[model samples]
Target chain A: MYLFRNYLLVFNILIFFQVSIFANNRDSILVIGKVSNNPQKHYSYLKPMLNYAVSHMKDLGIKKGKVLMARDNNQMIQYLQEGKIDWITESIFSALIYQQTTNAELLVRKWKKHSPNYYTIFISKKGNDINQLTDLKGRKIVLEDPGSSTAFYVPLMEMINAGLTLEFLHSVEKKPSGNNVGYIFANSEINIATWVFKGLVDAGAYNNEDWKKVDHTPVVFRKKLNIFHKSDTLPRSIEVVRNDLPDPIKKRLKSILLNIENDPSARNVLFAYQKTKKFDEINEDINNELNRARIVLNKVHENLNSL
Target chain B: MTMIIQCLKKINKLIFLILIPSLVQANSDLKPLLEVLKENETISSEQFEKIVDAVDNNDKNNLGIPAQINTKKNDEKELLIKIDNGLKISTYDGSANFSVGGRMMIDTAYYSDDKQPIGDGTEFRRARIEFNGKMYEVWSYQLDVEFGGGSADAKEVFLSYDGFTNKRIKIGQNKAPFSLEELTSSKHTTFMENALPNVFAIGRRVGILYESYQENWTFAAGFFGESFDNDVSKEGDESWGLSGRTTFTPVSEDTKVLHFGASLNYFDQEDNSEVRFRSRPESHVTDTRYLDTGKIKDVEKQYSYGLEFAAVLGPFSFQTEYINTHLERKIGGADDLDFFGYYMYGSWFITGESRAYKSKSGKFDRVKPLNEFGAIELALRYSMVDLTNGSVTGGETDQYTFGLNWYIKPNIKIMGNYVRVDNDINADEDGGVIGDDDPNIWQMRFQLDF
Candidate 1:
């Protein structure tokens, strides 16, 4: 009788486990959305992480998972406004835009590229007499493409705030006017450092993370460059969700992301997700941060449009 | 805090409205306006509760899913073809990929005269066709069949799931997670034939395996049944086994690696069981088995374990493994026997190409040629297997091999090997052939796969 009872108990547990694991209604699903120009690469990184998260959320009204890719911030903002997306992982600049245009709020801050925060640093070759933002008058400087936050917006904002006028130079050989600082797009950080090192440009600016990377700042260039200025730090990246998403789902997602680093098994998935280190909760201070980002984004947008 | 403050402000307005209805209790417009913006409006709150709940739910679903990555029509989804080591097709969404490939190895050899004649001739060593694919992003499968010996043999037919963070679970016919060289694909092995100790290796079987790995280590364990070719008719239970393997790499990269691993297999016999151990002189083209244990009956179980170490430094790399097998008889007296085998080899690539190591699977992968002509490698190996124990002499042999491999392409190569075999007096193949007979063997192979 004892063995029979034990077998019956085991059989019942197996049935319960099977039913819980495989039973899924079509009504409920978790959608992780991203604003990306490169959908194929982003999908590779998002699919595995979504599958893992959904596996643990099966009982919490999430039976399936899907990825939604938007081509730009405008498309993603429209996605959130239309309720087409449930969650978004984006940079602080994009997150601020989404917050203003839709009923979305910050859920967590992601340590993207293993950095919790990033700021721009203005650099010039050592002994070039370019000691400060004021020294770039009548000289050429290189910044990454217009889409970049660190190399373009932060650096541009700092120069404009310092009362220096910038000129758009189509060629690196072109010099600025007597009262202007000339700037050109290098297309990449490597080129930014190279053009400045070759004396084609007087100065270069990019994120501190790239400044330390060998691929972006070669060892040979690091010895020749001097950092003259550093911009204000901003949250590296953020994960936002619908403001009125059910509390249970929000709670579960927050818990999962916060503990992703605690489990050694998640190391591979985390590394693949843009080399994310960990997630920190977004407190009420996010309000002030977004407000400031709003001002900086507008100024950068206005300045770039004029150029 | 923001939501609370906003809710409080609305509550204050509701309070004023409650007073206003009293102040203007006779006004009809005020009555409807108060009811329009309702949340617990001076009743027991049952009726207002339902209305508020409905409004909240309507606001909650304000955002609904529209089009997504999988929104394209089935026929409109873009498919991309890639040609690398193999030809592969993948969807633009990165959700699915498939590849069709095969490998062929043709061999020829000559055996020196010994006490017994060992026949040598040209033959096809391996002719394989493989179909592998991944679907739904996390699910993958491989189906491979070998038609080398004028017959079809199932090899590595399995469906695998990699949905977990860094782990994988596979089911169906696959390898039993034992032996580093056994886990390495045959097309990538340096020599024309495996070292003699492969006699202790469990090549492939029907099994379910769970494997996980990181940047520096790999862990695999599985339970297995008999091979697909084991067509035995038995009234009693069939044989089964458990296998596990773990590998650690202090340094892991494509050109540089320091790897150490160990594996074990525990197999149980059926009610009526027998076992045999035999091996050739490390050359597949020869049809002579100078070492044989014949057959032992009343075997209860078998236990085997192996230790492996491998390293690659730039153009030079080396690998070594030692395996031991212990057998238990049903009589349970002093009849238990132990046998062992070990092999070590080293290779140098003269054309600046390095051996590739895959940390995820804890195995060596295909080597690519650096030069247009090809990468040439010279290698040497020493291997020995002893199957002799008290009252049961299988045989003992030592073999030395020299190899030259030319990798013309990533998936194409030619190999030449020379081997010298030395046997003990007990290496008589159960007295079917002369003992203490030494032989020299020469072999070459042309191989390609895609």
Candidate 2:
């Protein structure tokens, strides 16, 4: 009777172990993203690329991959904290937020939309007196959405560092008084250009790529505006993996992404994946820049708390 | 001093009761109001300082109106409407999407004097409205209607399942998998009309098709019956066909592409078995078809095949196609008939724009201008068709055409073409025999698509 009981206990343990192993293999890797309002469109472009990467990692025990999109950064943080998302690709600012909030580790730099990096440009009408960031006191300026790094955070950080007192205005037309630069969020790059060109705002700030694009700034508008200042270049986007992910899977994913350009079979999938040019290891310079951005973000938080 | 202290305490209690709500309501700093109270002698200096500290602490702890928690669930699905270069409407969550777009082609042509009467006039070559959308994330559908050719016609109306990677299955009326020129959208074609080889290409039909594509290649095959609104046979007999096409790109890039493709079609005719092949002189407004196979009678089966080759090098491109069709007669002792045609064309963009290539479909897409004024394209083509096979006397003809196109925008263009036609003595137009009459034609079209 004692021998039979021990045998049954061993058998049950084996079954449980097998079941757990199967469950892990079912969705071994999860690629997560923040859901754009257009989840289906986003999924359509994202699924194939992730599938390509997952297929290449089958030897690494990644049998399958799944994609999950959070509605916002807060939800994304929740998912990351729960270990539901093992890998991620997002803008640098969002990556920083996720890094600070969930301890996600940056894996590599991504050349999203075929651009490796972009810089913010401060613009005003050609005849305007605001040729530099210091002259923007007591005037209205427009920036892109608050979530945008190049258009919002980078430009705002530049102004703050230039010793200009800044106030977020409820509207673009509301002017602030006495050495304070009033700014409003335009929510779109084209809107920023239009607001500055039409004199609705005294100046505007956005990425230099948008400033050079004809669709955002037409030839006529281009002639009317002048880029007086440009911020330091920042990485276009980055890839991250949860710190708790298995070392082998993380290594395999990084290897696959970094070598996708060398694999001709992944060409179409890569092109469809937001027209990504390639992936490369994040250099020390970029890492240092990210650290600097973290400091700026921390300072901003401290200032807000002091208020 | 005791009386003053008592009065100040009473006033401070009243002020706290009144100003606390104001402070919460205003969402402002407490220092300014506290200073004002001290200046007005409403409170002592020590009381003012204490109250200021308490208010600041309360504000820091968010003891205000609970900071609008944004508890409002964002359950209302947002509908996104955008009008940039095109018009598109989609659900914010992307579970469902829809787009309404259309295209118009206005054509005019003038023909030189010919032995047979040929009409020269203006006509609406193609005017179509299309609705495309996705449902359930995996299903997509398109419905297109044409009002050109002076009548309403249904074009592509199909629903597709795109659940698999690099593959899709479609059902309903759609173009049969065939030649490259026949598959490319008319709005993006180099010429206003397709070339002679298109005569043998199976056009649109009601069908079910399966398609799969890789990075540099595509394969499409389908089984099709008569097109929508096709005339019903007397005994409800329907013709059916099986067709397939495959294309491979040995080298494909943004500015360069080399393509090779082939297609095969087998069609089973109805009991009557009557098929006709005809083409105009590279112009839409002209009604006379100098090259006509008239009618092949008692056709049991028809088999057609096409070969396509195309290449794009920077600002220049070359395209050519050859197609042949064989007919089997039902009557005994009747020899089988064969018809063949081919066309070659070359185009150069004066403003330096390469024709966009869609690798998934193995076809050329719209041309986008690099400049504000737009891009210019110059092209020349030579085509020949021979319908003179055993026991068939469908005259032979050759045509040379020169074209000029102005792309004002990605979706709008103006085009002009000059064609010179050469016909053999056996050629006939409008059921009249023409003794080797050659004609020159001039055609123009204004087109728009969104």
Interface RMSD of each: 11.3, 7.6
Tell me the TM-score for chain B of model 2.
0.84
Residue-level lDDT for B156 in candidate 2: 94
Off by over 4 Å in 1: A1-27, A33-48, A51-63, A67-259, A263-276, A280-307, B1-97, B112-117, B134-140, B161-163, B234-236, B332-334, B369-374
Which TM-score value belongs to model 2?
Answer: 0.69
Among the numbered candidates, top lDDT falls to: 2
Docking class of 1: incorrect
CA deviation > 4 Å runs, candidate 2? A1-31, A34-41, A49-88, A101-236, A240-271, A275-307, B1-77, B270-272, B433-435
Model 1, range B1-450, lDDT digits (tens) per residue?
A: 979977886787667646653444333234344365453334325544543443333322221102122222322134667676577776645567788899999999998867778887998899999999888877989999999888998888999996776688999899898898888998999988888889989878888999987757899999988887776766777788999999999997546899999999998987647788888888877767878888877789989999999999877999999999998988754488899999999999987677889887899998867455888999999999998998888889999999999999888999999998899999988898999999888999999998
lDDT of 1 by residue, A171-235 (tens): 77777788898888898888898787777888999999888764577555677889999987888
